[model samples]
Target: MRDFFEVRDVHVMRSGAHGPLPVLGGVDLRVGRGELVCVVGPSGCGKSTLLGVVAGLLRPARGRVLLAGRDVTGTPAHTAYMPQQDLLFAWHTVLDGVALGLRVQRVGRREARARARDVLAEFGLEAFADARPDELSGGMRQRAALARTVLQGRDVVLLDEPFGALDALTRLDAQRWLAATWRAHRWTGLLVTHDVGEAVTLGDRVLRLSGRPAVVAQEVAVDEPRPRTPGVPDERVVRTVLAGLGVVPDERAPDEREPDERAPGLPVRLP
Candidate 1:
């Protein structure tokens, strides 16, 4: 199949207190249908900024963003963006909140609500459909947000640290759920996360960006299968990188160090 998303020679800049700053520098990326690509980099690198550019929320000063071969630069509606926060409204029930996106697009009230309910059910949130956000746990709220994004019916989804705040168990659960959900729906997804484990667990290919004026530094492929198991060799790669970046420790057998942990996403600060 042809690539569902393509970005070429992309460059992005922002004007800050110091003046014009280069965010993304000549970055090239492509994602086939159902591909999940993770971007890892140092803090303050343009990881989130690159996501915004791909989502068409921010136009690159130079380059092109093509969705299924058509340029979508400066077009925001072609993609669904899920930020760090679920952004769930405490006053609205899960059904009502998830339906907001569809309603905004003028899908009739009954139709939108139905679509929302169905999507929420797929994520195992059917029982909580009438529950308010405050009643849901952090992970459930995030799941509700995912359902809302899916209901928006966008071909691409940009996830910005959607599982960052969850505890380890919840994070693992969410990751498994995401892989299953992505497989079933086959939406092209680009996820921005600070967690190396999350990136390796969900991404088909992981892209690393250098800090601001962020250029694609390196690309790592996570060739493992879905339902990633702990203590697996692939999972070790995640810990290796974490240790190398000083986030964790280089506690593995000494010979295991150099090649395995070399990818990227080292914590900005060493332990």
Candidate 2:
């Protein structure tokens, strides 16, 4: 089957204080229709920058972005992006916040709000529909933001550390919630996260990126079926991914050390 979304030989450079700095160097990726792919990399390894390029928020110096066989380079209309923070409008009610996308599409206020309410109900946020951003918990806020993203009905969703800010328990809840939601709608998703366990649990495949001008170092297929529980990914898969990223000692190492005892959410140093 033809790929649903693709980033072909993408190269992105940014102007730093001193000079030009390369963020992505000849990066290539593809996500099939109804597939969920998670990208895990060291902190400041240009994961978010890569997502921005794909979302058309930033243009790559070279290479093309294709969505469902159509080239959409530098076109933000083709995808919906949800950043690390929920960025909810503090003044607007939860319902209105979720309805923002539809309203932007020239949907009537009444109709947009009705659609938002239905989706919010599906997300189990109906009771908080009238609540303001401040009134909802951190998890609820993220859920509301996701509702807005889904309401846009875009073919691809770019999530940049969407659950990074939540507490352990809350993040787990959000992960499971997102996985179930994705299974229901099956919109192609590319999520950039630092949590290895999260990637293993939520993604159909996890891509590990490393180095200064990062490229895909390895792609580990989850193989497990979804509706997966958060924080409970297959230990073997997690170990394989960590080893590929050099987060854990490689089995081939002559003097292999015990697996790192650090918690799952801690940042993995780039080699």
Report the C-alpha lDDT of model 2 over 22-76, residue by residue, as the tens digit.
9888788889998889999888889999999999999899999998888999999
Q: Candidate 1 on 1-271: residue-level lDDT in tens?
A: 4588888888988888989988877888788888888888789888888888888888889999988789899898889999999998889999999999998898998998888988988999999999999999988999999889877989889999998899988888888788888889878899998888778878887776766777765566687877675223376667645554466777766665444244453312101
Clashing residue pairs, backbone N/CA/C < 3 A, model 1 = none
Reference-based TM-score of each model: 0.86, 0.91
**lDDT leader:** 2
Q: How does model 2 score by TM-score? A: 0.91
| Candidate 1: residue 215 Cα off by (Å) | 1.0
Predict model 1's lDDT versus the native.
0.81
Candidate 2 local lDDT, residue 213: 85
With candidate 2 superimposed using the best TM-score fit, by how many Å does residue 43's alpha carbon deviate from the native? 1.0
Tell me the spans in candidate 2 whose CA falls farther than 4 Å from its real position.
252-271
- In model 1, state the lDDT of residue 247: 67
Worst 10-residue lDDT window for candidate 1 reads 262-271
